[model samples]
Target: MDDFYSKQSPFNPDVKSFRFYKNGNLKIELKTKEDAEKVARLLLP
Candidate 1:
């Protein structure tokens, strides 16, 4: 997850932080709900 964040964050400054859980859940913190939704869409398969 750290590698993914490091590579992706440079292109997205709005992404403030991220957490990956053992239960296969990822939590991403962005500047706004809209931005979060956009990132989620981009990350989803």
Candidate 2:
């Protein structure tokens, strides 16, 4: 699942950078909240 995100997003060190839960929820830990939101929008349905 993490590997899928790494391939989709530009962010590196995917495991440390992003977290995806089983309920289709996304938690992104990064300096740029805006960037995280962008990725989240793309990811979420």
Q: What is the lDDT of residue 26 in candidate 2?
A: 66
Query: Cα lDDT for residue 22, model 1?
Result: 58
| RMSD, candidate 2, Å | 7.5
Residues 1-45, candidate 1, lDDT per residue (tens digit)?
343423124336787767666566666678888987887799898
- Write candidate 2's Cα lDDT for 1-45 as tens digits: 343233234356533355556666666665666766876898899
Error of 1 at 29 (Å): 0.7
Residue 35 local lDDT, model 1: 88
Off by over 4 Å in 1: 1-11, 37-45
lDDT of each: 0.65, 0.56
> Which segments of model 2 are wrong by more than 4 Å?
1-29
Which predicted model would earn the best lDDT?
A: 1
